[model samples]
Target: MRSKHPPARAAEAGNSTTRQGAASPGVQFLTVPADLAGQRIDNFLQSRLKGVPRSRIYRILRKGEVRVNKGRVKAEYKLQPGDVVRVPPIRTAEQAPAPVAGDQLRQLVEASILYDANGLLVINKPAGLAVHGGSGVRLGLIEVLRQMFPESQFLELVHRLDRDTSGAIMVARKRAVLTHVQGDLRAGRLEKSYLALAVGKWPRGRRLVEAPLRKNTLKSGERMVSVDPEGKPSETRFQVLERFRGATLLAAEPVTGRTHQIRVHAQFVGCPLAGDSKYATDEANRAFREVGLKRLFLHSSVVGCSLPGGQEVRVEAPLSEELESVLAELRSGTGVPLQP
Candidate 1:
């Protein structure tokens, strides 16, 4: 909902320690831009304070170190244009981060570029690379892109791909483009297709799975998803692309994005993905691994969307050589496609 009132604007009193008056060195205030409106408070803070940990930001928010319009707001509060934001003094590393030399990774990603225009970049992300760095990962694809293009003032991920799933991933070069693409995604205007090899033969004809998924974190801190009545709604469409002796190649398209939707859905149908470390059967995985499959046999194959200028853009990424080789071996084996 758009606010009819004037855009929120912030006025900073010089050196105020807190929202109230006290001498503080790092206190500052900023007005939210119209383009930045509707974003969560914590997200805004993360973007503004590039190096700050998300946990620290939430801590400050809990302690009332941050305020908007002279009042404290929850982390989920959406920013309205012209809203004044009071940023409390934050402790940062005294030494600047060492410069990253991302030449090798940058070249690899550059070679994987499928589309770049109108403030959007589409890249065929390589397998085994996290989209963004954290959780024991030193650097990720986004960090490498930042170093790859030093002059780019802004770059953000519009959506995410799992660490092991390789294929088309969107990168927004501008805030407006990010907003536009995200809106399209929410409205189902953007379409994405992924290719996967799942254990067992896939049944013929178009299949749609409308199963709700609930996320669960186990005692060991492993995250998993399952079909639960109380879970959020989820949907995935599947078409059998090929069949092998004991495996099937499938075209999987998720209508609603959820964590591990495709993998979980495949499991729901009793055919977990081949080479899936987290979700596949250990015996099946070992069999596939013995045959030379190293990573999850899933790839983001294609993406389609309409631009603000009425132009339709579609991008595609072919299967990686490693995966294709495995498919060829599977085809030559004893299994055959099921007859219609």
Candidate 2:
């Protein structure tokens, strides 16, 4: 899971790219080899990825990104060597990309109603809060939607956002746009862009991390990511915009769609998301939390595409105040920024 396509061709579904939200994102499923079947999940990935890495490998394991026996399994468990490792579709910004709720969220829907004909509602989604429901998340973007638009005939998500991510989200008022958009994403047409706060310093200029990603599953269904040859191909490009103490503000463009591709790739290169608890060290998480960084430090800044009928739609949203505050602290050179 690396990147989505470019901006111009983002919306041309009746087969030329930009077809996301018309249907579920397209996916190709393949299983790991049985020859390396009996090895431990982590060990196998580590060996296969020679120049890749171990921390990322182990992290993928914890996320249950990697599978054994054709289903989700732990990393510590010994593989029978031939056990099939199922690599699930990694979520780019489109993954679990739930919408935002609150007075502000409603305002966005009403304000950015690009084209609301026949049940297709395209609006910018804010970072944080999921598009759908999941563990530890009760009220999500869609849930709040039902509260306000209760009588609407159809209000379903075309995709998702990580709990901390935000950006262009597509909603299907009717089933037609939903079906078409999903089909388009599958065909690799629609694309998305994101702005994130990364941990640590970066190279002097634009950099790219391209690696095959394999999700490693650990006990209790924890999933982590890593760069491995035995894993599916994943790529990420970064442009360092600003550098702060122990962190960098970057505009990351993922080439292949993968779970935490930006996060994982950043961490793989020694720069996890500053406020991320899933991949960063406990100290960093604690430090950022003290500075009012209560949420993930990623934001989906813009989304656009060419639609049928020669319509081009683009939506943009700002980063959350929480993240903004932290950036301000970094910018102001505050005394060891406070945490949440």
Candidate 3:
């Protein structure tokens, strides 16, 4: 990343004093390509902004810094191909800052590479790790990825797995590749699936989840998801694969990506995942947690996408052995009736 000490200009000295923020007010222009036309403004920024957080993209839109074809567009406005977009200069020091991950976390993320081909890098992210730094999380997987692959200039994430969800993550080795892959994802041409276990004898069969997700913040500041029409639409197609004593192991395929969409929707349908402490009921959560179900029982098991070379790549990361063992214990304990 280039470090340009703002030219000591009449622009607010206090604003430019900080060595960081988002889009350097030095101002840059982005041309919407033909394939990516008709995408939403916020989604467009989410893909285009290099390091800025996705949550903050809407904030920039409200600031009028993102203009489409010389006019401000709504966050929901669909962008047309070849639309000229102006990305106003921001104090680089404030918005999309550099990685602040500690040494240990950085080392772990760098060493988890599964493969690297051309302008695409593959990583097997472990559970209990965040993909990027956020929400007071000091170290995320991407922080280390950047530290180790600095020479791979223009590195960026094609998609996010989740904070606690572990699995194969794909990174773009080059900027053009990043944008191209994102085009495929936004067009509903990309596919990713997860493996999970749900509690309480679910009906044997495949089920489709059509849940609208809305963010609801708890008093403790922890955010959660709930079913609300006002919320964003989310879908997950699930099929029961195995049945435990009181649980059914299933394969979850999320059709639409939404925060906490899978976990919340699964619970809403009457079967909370075995170890989900956040949305699971007290009895189910406590009973499972006692048997070593400490973290959320969700793993992004597979990632599939089309590369710039026109080749399809699919990678799978099995669930952690520890989580699997915990599931075994939970199933066995139900029959033995272990004392609390």
| Whole-structure CA lDDT of model 1 | 0.79
- Candidate 1 lDDT tens digits, 216-236: 999986789999999999999
Indicate which candidate wins on lDDT. 1
Q: Distance from true position, residue 55, model 2, in Å?
A: 30
Error of 1 at 313 (Å): 0.8
Instruction: Give the Å error, residue 264, model 3.
Output: 2.0
lDDT of 2 at 214: 87
Residue 89 local lDDT, model 2: 38
TM-score of 1: 0.83
Residues 159-182 of candidate 3 have per-residue lDDT tens digits of 887777777888877755776777
Error of 1 at 213 (Å): 0.7
Provide the clashing-pair count of each candidate structure. Answer: 7, 73, 13
Candidate 1: where is the Cα deviation over 4 Å?
Answer: 1-29, 38-43, 53-88, 93-101, 204-206, 334-340
Candidate 2: worst-modelled 10 consecutive residues by lDDT:
11-20
Number of the top-ranking candidate, with TM-score as the measure = 1
Superposed on all Cα atoms, the candidates' RMSDs to the truth, in angstroms, are 5.9, 15.0, 6.5
Q: TM-scores across all candidates?
A: 0.83, 0.61, 0.74
Return whichever of 1 and 3 wins on TM-score.
Answer: 1
How far off is residue 39 in model 2, in Å?
36
